[model samples]
Target: MAPTLPFRDINVHASPSHYAFSSPSSPSSPTLVVDRPSGDLRLHDGKLLGTQRVSSIAGILGIIKLRLDKYIIVITKAQPMGRLKGHMIYKVIATEFLPLRERPLHDPDEDTYLSLIKTLLKTGPMYFSYSFDLTNSFQRQAESDTSAPLWKRTDDRFFWNRFVQTDLIDFRTGGGNAHGFRQSLGQQPGMDPYILPVMFGMLEIKNTSIKGKPLTFVLITRRSRHRAGTRYFSRGIDEYGHVSNFNETEQAIILNDDSSSGLGGFAGDLGYQNGKIGGAAAQERQVLSYVQTRGSVPVYWAEVNTLKYTPTLQIRGVESATQAAKLHFDEQIRLYGDNWLVNLVNQKGRERRVKEAYEQLVKSLVSAPTEDTEADRVTREKFHIVEPERQKHELDRLHYIYFDFHNETKGLRWHRAQLLMEQLREPILQHGYFRGVDPPAVATESKSGTDRRLW
Candidate 1:
């Protein structure tokens, strides 16, 4: 196959354009990377990696950093339905993981790690726009220390693991863009020339009717670009312990006075919420509540086969399932504090074991008396099952394998979103509401280009 130069046709309008390599779409062949001015194409080994036709390509999703190397992530557009208006209408059907270089560490765990990461890439449910810069925008919010130009980056904490992974990946993958980012580290950086990831579902509630105080709460969830396939197709855990689905979920609350609170230019204030709109005194008084959670493929073992109308199921064992549940709850406590309400949905059939295991684990944590009376009391009061009376307090689910992006995941998310809304509804309706108000700006800045609205 003939290797192609990435972004060769587009005018980067710079000499000595920095280049990075993507993993090969297939195991047998190497793909190409480019130097803008010279128009030279080569592989990580300094061999010339070639490219195919532009019509055959969709776009690059920005380079990803792996443990030892960097890979150019490509989204290929497929035109199975044929062409229109002299153009081939394409959809991003597949991703190509082209490696930039050979693995450096020869550890026994390296192979397993690579396979797990690949599984994440192949399985991740990603839809790309030939126009939007999903990679750079995500990195800026998640990895970049400096802010972007058109859209302001949200709080780094809003996309916690997403930022962690990208930063580590950038460090491990070596330098492509970071080389340039380093020079402007201390100095005030220019606005980023990238677009934020597209958000599918957004909730905006205007709370003016109930009380004299008028406030708005906006919630947006940016789906992880790294998504796996539907829940039914993928199976088992890879070496790294990541299961089928992995993605970041961001939740933000926007509040403003009635006068300045129209969607027309309201997002401009989001930048102020980054806790950096003014000096130290101003930052300290800001009151913004942004929280992020994650949903991934279950760590337990299960397989699905299309041959049968319904896939055969297996529980694998109780030990691993228990451990996975323990680790998950532990992390939640560590991040969000010990106050949690464990909700175990009972069901018949295979899920019975999984649900039972989770319930038992929660019971163990709450029932086990510790030496510290205060600690024991907190555990007992804060953790409990979701009974019919306390439905308002429930906010999250403990599903081992949440089929994110599928119909099943959607229903689950909607259910949770409703629960959250219910928690807020009763209080707002009862008293209109009164509290300390120092809400942060909820603006979004992006690189100057064809802009898209995520609201």
Candidate 2:
């Protein structure tokens, strides 16, 4: 029940001496803003006014503006897995009661406030922050019971942490029959425990549209057969019409696996569609469709596995074309080099042939044509070199999200990797033996004498 401090980024590094977070295996603190008291204007007779005071409004508005400026607008009504409902409203609201924190101060007036001013000058004018010690609840409780050392003159130096109810987003399952168990590695309790999650890591993203409106996009993640219980991810619109946000505290307590097919039952067709997983094929689809459907909201993709381990699945939306194209080329090239250019007795043999063809392509600077079976015996005199297909300059946006795998939501996405493996294993290569150098360097044809690469 202790308060949480400014959260540390999951990827950040810290040495023991400077690090603040003490424990992790322990559950995270509830992140809601609770215990809010409506501020009232007191009458001369000590009567309470019906509304909050002007100062309270200013304080809340100040914090809201600060948050808006500091963080891009993510208008969240759906709490992520590790968060509580209403966590956002309460966090900004709680900052109101504390007077110790202030906006930029004007010139200090007195010698008495000089030390405070000097301390601010030496350290920082920013708000002082802290988190509750989660390791020792009793120690924190005992410490809260005691008064501060006779050091500070103002109660404003202290801050109280906040929390919300333990509500979670339930990602409903697609019926009792999921493809997870069928395509899984055969084992009751088999496979490395770590790699097991990889089975459930597959996810997809799709374009969404309402009848007359422009195409709106959403990122969807799936959670199936959770161990703790069911999670309901059914859609509902509150008084406000956001499709995914659920505001009614009165939601029926059915698990994500609610059997009653009522208010919240199951995920519809979006569950079983074909999309790239983490391999090379996935990269191609993700980048291609993303660029194809430019200028729309980006939704992160996720899903749960019904496999040996039902770890949560996640695939983030791509941001830029340059990045996307780069990632796309890198992954596809890997597949082409290692999987496509081969011929052998078995699957392994096919893989070896692909590797050989890839080496030939890079070394001889030419691709073997798939038109005939005698491509392997092709001589240097018969080689034909061609430039990569060029997309328009604007299409280079594909290079953004497609460029870097690190920028991809889930780390080490291999969506197309497996498919590329299969493709490279195929015993086909493109080349030309019946040729002449009398042809033009660039092929072109028109009404006049338009002939170019005919060379």
Candidate 3:
């Protein structure tokens, strides 16, 4: 696979009929053209005549359609956040929307939709990288196929622009008249250089030394787009088991044994292929990553706002709560083995109901019977007789813990958190974490394989 060279500085030109995006650094690169009448996107080799330069942008984010017309979103400004394994990550600081229509639409609802899109872009935190796959963790990237494009391998849950980038992706995949366009433009069949994937999350990088060794600590939190909303507006699990406000937080530490190594040596290495370093140059760096998730309780409950200090708490769908909880836990177990569900709600008052409901739902799942046939039951009986301990351990997977945060941390005694730690210390220690080293031979293997490797 050829190396990916992202377009860094793009010049935007607007003609009366279309808009053209071209890179000033690489003049030979194909220009992205968007027709004004139909909002169709294509590649152009020659510049559009009689066009005026509109703005300089970092990259094209994607295109979104309002009630009246389609508008292309572009990154007007971006700032470097940090680097991971030589890949420079950037955060979208400002953005601008260019309407595909030459004239403005007078529809009333179009303004509201446009305002909503602007609000989301302004408030949401978005980050992207030219070479790095920001939607996936280090472990996932190490195991994934390296030959594929970055956009194809992105996790849909964190790909914030996935829906809006459908046209571009389809064009690249030969969905419509892309074949003729690619043939005319002489573009390759691999990843499209202009199709950029943006992730909505929080990222922080700190450079410091630990015991005379160079260390880089990074914290990234990715919010799930499924059933996402502000608190008090969205709550509980849906029919598909998606919870509100779900987020994955990852803390990564990159340590280098060679103190003489500079940041320039780490740039553009692409180091996570098959759990091995990119080349001999990056063999001294060691990476360790740990991920944890937080979400609303995966049960049928909601807080209804009634213009009061406290909203009314309601728990519905009691009959289907068990199935929903099962779906949620099953997926969790499949992704991260042996879930350690820590409930941090009050044990009394209105919160007590939620706490009890959660406990009961977990208990039912643990005690539920399996739909086994006669032959399957006989085989299980024999296997259990031979390996009872292993069978029991496999059968009982979920562990639940309840702690009253408000009651324990009352009177400014925040040290009471030690109690919760004491209860979870054993399980956490046993669960362990993920570490990636330079050589594939010396890397620590995950005991549970892919299941324990957090995304």
Highest lDDT, which number?
A: 3
Q: List the lowest-lDDT window of 10 residues for candidate 3.
A: 380-389
Candidate 1 vs candidate 2, TM-score winner: 1
Backbone clashes counted, model 2: 77
Looking at model 1, residue 16 earns an lDDT score of 29
lDDT of 2 by residue, 1-455 (tens): 22222222211112211111111222242111111121110102121223332221111111111211111011111112211111111111111112222335543443234444234323321111112111111111222322221111112101111100000000001111122232222221111110101001112222333453222122211121111121323221112212122110100111111112121111111212354222321111110011001111112222345554544533332222224323323433321221121222121222323223322332222232223211122121111222223433322211110111122213556573343234323222221111111011222121111111000
In model 2, which runs have C-alpha deviations exceeding 4 angstroms?
1-52, 55-98, 101-216, 220-263, 267-455
* Off by more than 4 A, model 3: 3-6, 104-108, 176-191, 257-283, 368-395, 439-455
Cα deviation of 255, candidate 3, in Å? 0.3
Model 1 C-alpha lDDT per residue in residues 1-455, reported as the tens digit of each score: 21121221121111224343333343222334445422233333322334332323344444455555555455553323221111122333565555545445565665667678567645543332222222222223223323233123333322223332343223323422333452222321110211122222222333332344333443334443233446765543444333344333333332333433321111222233454543432321111333344443233556557587777766565455545555544545443332223222323456545555544443343433221111122122212232222222222322121111222224445553343344334423442211222223333332221111100
| Per-residue lDDT of candidate 3, residues 1-455 (tens digit) | 44454577889999878999888887877788888856767777766778999999988898887776889999999999877866789999889999877555477788788888889998889999877888887666666655577787787778888888876777667654332353233333432777788989899988888667568898998888788888998988888878888887878888763334322212223355676644454555666777777788888889999989888999885667777777777777766677766777776678877876776666566644232111132122111000112225332577666666666667898997787687667767787766655532233322212224221
lDDT, each prediction: 0.34, 0.19, 0.71
Compared with the true structure, model 3 gives a TM-score of 0.81
Model with the higher TM-score, candidate 2 or 3: 3
- At residue 3, give the lDDT of candidate 1: 15
TM-score of each: 0.40, 0.16, 0.81
Lowest-lDDT window of 10 residues in candidate 2?
Answer: 163-172
> Could you tell me how far off, in angstroms, the CA of residue 80 lies in candidate 2 after the best superposition?
17
Evaluate residue 293 in candidate 2 and report its C-alpha lDDT on the 0 to 100 scale: 11
